[model samples]
Target: MPSPFRLRATALTTTALLLSALATGCGDDGGTDEDLTAQKLSWKDCPAPSQAEGGGSAPSPLPDGQRWQCATMKAPLDWNHPKGDTIGIALIRAEASGDPSRRIGSLVFNFGGPGGSGVSTLPAFGTDYDTLRTRYDLVSFDPRGVGRSAGVKCENDQQLDAYFQQDSTPDDAAERTGLLDNTKEFNAACDKNSEKVLPHVRTTDAARDMDLMRQVLGDTKLHYFGISYGTELGGVYAHLFPKNVGRAVFDAVVDPTQTSEQGALGQARGFQLALDNYAEDCTSKIEDCPVGDTPQDVKDRIAKLLKDLDAKPLPGILPRQLTQSAAITGIAQALYSKDFWEFLTEGLEQAYDGDGRILLLLSDSMNGRSENGEYSNIAAAGVAINCSDDKPRYSPGYVEGRLPEFRAASPLFGDFLAWSMVGCTDWAVPGAADHPDVSAPGAPPILVVGNTGDPATPYEGARKMVDALGDGVGVELTYKGQGHGAYGSKDKCVQTAVDGYLLDGKVPASGTICA
Candidate 1:
């Protein structure tokens, strides 16, 4: 069976709301943009320890869904004080049925989000990921500060509603300043409100929580596949608990080593490349894809359209207009699935004319918001997880300085997208994780999968992490595919490679390219 691709049933989104809850510690650049430089920080740099979330001993498993049960686990709101009070962590389990005698211990999975929720996945992914379910009793969880488990909400729904509506791509100095100020305010609010939870949102805490789950589950070893940001979680696990590793597969991996600027730039370039792919495929499908005959032409033309939107958002069905931020929401959604490419074209066409329905739908999907005014717990957990994982440079002037370059590279949606992280600047109760180098020391070989044109987690990141892991154990398998997570999209070649690795522990031979 192929290793499962995480969450095709759900669309990608951002969890900016959590940042506002974390406002206590965000920073501003008093100096010029050039003054913003990567600071070398260490474990000592983490935020001060705080009070844990409900420290009543982590609760036991609860009846939840078909093939899965919920288990309440807990870790310190601060890992530094492991013996201190603990917070409840939501966990889910789906045990193998076919032959329990052949069980391969528990496999824990984390679908990445700075705010991604693992608990919600059981209902969405269910047995569709049977390969993983059939061997180990697959476990998923909502790390602290996520849905149905616990969260440190600072802003009310109305404030969050207001925040998402803010244009991501700032047009003039005023718009830019407004966005900056709003972000600072949001970040500051989080710092003050979520004092306890914010201090423990780091990946290290989540990883440690996972370790506690592993022990609680009675699994002697940890077998898992972590996609997108989940890759960082696995890397940290490997770095901290190498002895516990087992049959680990990191697909569409993240390069945890890069600085925030490098990371953002890498994403910008990846989106540019993915957009090139979209243009080619889009033009092949539609005779008039806006730009000239060439793909670059389409890219350039689309770039111009975004800039136009930024300057004067065109009116649409809803109160909001078509802005560069909205365009990006559409573009990123399309990059997630080849099937959604038309959404981008339709959105562009609507913008060319005057419609915002399709664009709003894309934004809705990107925001992971439901029609009922509520949002994804996955997104909520994602921000909690991301803000605490590794520090991103959030100086006030940072976005202003890099705005031009990001916009130039991602003309359709770059500048405001770059500014999307303003809330992190004032993140409170830091408690960040250590930069774990995950080489799977002395452990069995780890399979690293990459899709050629994965926009969110680029293929190059897979290569970079693989090379950095140094141990002779790293294996890279390139799927000549598109989109974000690629392990389970079902191109026979890709499926076969992953199946071979997961079942037989066979790493795809180096230089192996599977389409």
Candidate 2:
């Protein structure tokens, strides 16, 4: 299963196909000191996305006819030894469209995933931020060890197919052994294929790269729009260079205070809450609920279906079966946004009839698998970055011991998430810290937006992030909405507050609510 923390803004569109395309080759390492900061990027017309970046055609011109430009920024391969070796950080941007007098440098974006390709993602959602583009160059990038920027590689497409299909929620010691063996094999593949880049892909490293990017972009301070794991990255940047932070926003915020195990437990509960909300919304509709008569009935039926799938898998996409793990993943994917609930309803309806294509497609989206059976490096990078940043290496025994607590939090999602805690087993690199440090006493106020119905990062994490970001640093904004993020939900109040802060430097009052 993919990490619960992975958030792709465009994964819900199944019709979108990614063709096989050439991967972006890494640039040569640069020499020391002043030369690096003074490096000028050679921006050009953006090309079709590479296979590792989740292949797709080049971004279309903006509504106003401005073409998206792509470039590579050089940063030290290892921050500890800045003069030693360098790696390229892929970037995409649309220059500010408004008056020259109003231009406010760049507004960098990181759309979570810790593994997502922002070069590809920013184009898909470019229009959503056109208002902000009036005053800032809308920019986003694929962080180190992600897409085109020294992307991490592990397992072939075929290997990944079997890997994701294996029963993640093990039933016995034999099944447990198989799961561990598979995880070890995947980790070994990453070590073999991307050994040079693994140790340098931590969030702190990415934060440092952003500062370098700020210098290269000729900006006095870093202006950012971060979501999900990006929030953690932004917080780290603030901690490292609080005075360098310009106007920024953290949506779908991750809790910086929780350890890996605690984070997983929170996700189990968060996903369960989203599921409950989804079920309630379905049943409350005037139209007769197709899945069940009541919310409990809906959940009970889903539990039964999962139990049945554990024994006899349903036929899904060609040559693949919808295993219990895939179904759970598909369900989790749908729960990310309320807009996908109808698909979840349809997927469940199809599964009940012994057809599993829809649900499997959802699973594929969650895993970053393209229609052509090619997968981006999202899973590989997700595991690598997660393993490198998280200090704990959970044993199967440790996971087994915590099953009941996880299950108590979410009966449907507990086992899957609990088992995922062992993802870093036998990792090539040791982790950096117990949890990320986001404390920034001197940073500017960052508008922190939290969706009450977020399935990946729980609602409570918003407050935790605010508290962890230190006094007067994090400005909390609540959106009583559903989805992985509040801004993308198109709530007028939320967008207005964010636009006001980013475009006009008018921060909304702390603890402001948007319903």
Candidate 3:
């Protein structure tokens, strides 16, 4: 799904990366050396989520059960000076179900987003991993700039509400000026409210925190399952401590090889391809589909709707109107999973009938705007982490110059996605990061999963990631399906490959395809 805060990947087939894992060296200290010691975690029961007051949706509630233990860990704000200004890393651990004597070690899970809340994400899946849960404690943490941890806060609800309602697909100089103005406004809000934590929340810092968590959890090596953007985190961890890398799975892999602009174009094409796939499915499955029989027709219809919305906003569910931005977001949200296609169809059908409540609602859902008018910090954190992680340089003229290239990439969704990068131009901190060179020479075998029809992270990017990690060390598992992620799906082949790797150190043969 194209959240205003997520990253993108593209198609560029290359040779698989392979290099046998052999004993090698430790990572060069990026800067300072302070003692890296584990901190004690005082586990306590988690409080029940605040109930949604009246109508609309709240984010999915924490799953019931007392199996969850909440704790906070102290980590340096500056990894170079570990003893200096510390920040809290919030963690949630679910104990294993099998015999205590048979227990393996802690299994760390990250659900991408650079901003995704592992504390919220873990509980929904800890039980579903069935066998793996019994053998190891499933633990997840809110990385420094996310969830209960020291988070990045930007514009408040009122400001963001108005921001989301702005027309993203600007048609003229005036609209373009407004778009850039809003970008600067949001950027300024983040710098004003989160200056202390913004520069410190880089991927390297989070990877360093993971190592400390492993030490605290008493694991000799790290066993991790990271999806989407999480794959980048896993890659960084493996590169930093190759010897400490145990069983690791990087699913829906992001190519650590691409620059930010390349990644954007890649995602533009990927989302376009996914929309085509959705169009094909709709023509065959749904009766009287509004998108039509061919992909081109679908693109044309969507383009027309966006143009119309740009010219005149539609009446929506509440005070806000359905602007081009929300319409694009709603469409992109459904493209993430095939299961959400029906909702997309309903939303489009309603829009066709001159009522935009469904599409507007879906957009709000994707953006994490709560029913009671409060907004989640996800959008803020997402922008903060991404901009800090990779400093994007694009003026309005520069981005405008790339418009034709973007539209050529994806006729319906390209321009909006490409222009979304403008906010990073004025990012407060000059990014001191890049995609980490992830060929960890002596790491244990790492499995990378790719979905053939994934929209957010393209299949080709997965292949490229494997190539970057090296062919000998990285194994590719393919799911011939549609979705942004492969694991936790009903695909038995994927489940078996992932489970076997995490539980029994079983590696799927090279070129393993899971349909």
Candidate 4:
């Protein structure tokens, strides 16, 4: 089913990004009745969604759970020409639970993949909306080029599989060279295969789509909740339609202006910092962390493990390579969900035992390879979205040159993670113009959340985004949690403060720290 917040990517496409004349956006208090009337005749014919086989339409499927209705909202394929070539976004609307006497309107959610499908997030975030949903329709959708949307797929599935065969973690120069060559070939394939939608995957496109969704749902305003890349998406929408924002919450915000190279460099430091904290926690449960005693010791052992796999590929838990690429992917994925922290040791053990099973599973999940050896529809979109959203500059020497900074900042993940963005170096076009619209943001004082030790988005990033968004007049909410998105984790102290802002429209006083 097409989902919301989460999305997929596309191949390099043609851009006839002719700015279309769209109706004026809804005002800050959503819009006046006149605003609604003004927009009534503007919506185009949207493609109707196909019914999910054998499902009823309630909130979600809950014969024992709930049911869901497939909803579609029409948006311009390119917003600059709003009334032009139209594309329809699919949505799953989970209505409020309580008395209809007090409905809130709508709460659109974004789950972070830039490729993650958003359909399944309702049950996940529904609890928080309990009070709010009583009044609002919870709308979520997979952005264009993503699932359920007329998706963007590249290369026949088989050729795509061939690209995954390289040694993820290269031991010798030969494998590393081959990997780089493959990345270029892969990028070329994307350009040739899915060139139609690639140029249109910018965050601004998604933001405009959300506004269309709001009008279709008949909501006067947008009560948006964004996390991770989702936060970036929301920021773009707010910037584009500042007055349309009504009690929006941007958790784990992203500074879209930040380059992937800069982000990777910063993340190198953040991951190691988080790992250091994990190490402390690791020792409390397992003697020597079951990985290694000292931080450097653990790094050495993992490095040795990487080299071992480089020489001989193991029959990992999955059919992928047991290369350092596999291990690093596993580590990066684990870095986000502390609940999965225990898996690190297990992944380490399997790799250490020369099994390479657990690490493979983690790697596959990350790169979107399936167990039966099928690639996921999500990966195509993931790469497309990221490459298009922010065309990173990773030359042959980019990784090596930045190694020292990465190492100093993130002794554990510096080199490997920095190289991860290297794939983008070979991307055909540099990402779309960095949403020039984002340059000016007079959007309300949005709150920016940063964990003291978030691996994916550094604390510094949170600070940077908050400052950038409000011209250095935003509030920073720090929850001493360890995960990619912490707001929904039910950390009472954090929730109360965030809820007050959303429900009461009260900004946390300046310098609010929620730990």
**What are the lDDT figures for the candidates, one per model?**
0.61, 0.89, 0.75, 0.62
Q: Residue 244 in model 2: shift from native, Å? A: 0.4
Query: How would you encode candidate 4's per-residue C-alpha lDDT over 28-110 as one tens digit per residue?
Result: 32331333224432322223322211011223343224344456555667656555566656677666665677666778887
Candidate with the greatest lDDT versus the true structure: 2
Q: Could you give candidate 1's per-residue lDDT for residues 109-224 as a string of tens digits?
A: 77765455566544455555676555667677766776545675655555755666676566578887887777667667666777667767777666666666666666667787
Provide the TM-score for each candidate, comma-separated: 0.82, 0.96, 0.91, 0.83
Error of model 2, residue 193, in angstroms: 0.6
- Stretches of candidate 3 off by over 4 Å are 1-36, 49-66, 290-295
Give the lDDT of residue 380 in candidate 2: 92
Quote the positional error of residue 432 for candidate 2 in Å. 0.6
* Candidate 2: regions farther than 4 A off: 14-32
Q: For candidate 1, what's the RMSD? A: 10.8
Lowest lDDT sum, 10 consecutive residues, model 3, at: 10-19
TM-score of 4: 0.83
Clashing pairs in 2: none
Off by over 4 Å in 1: 1-9, 12-66, 286-297, 314-321, 377-380, 430-436
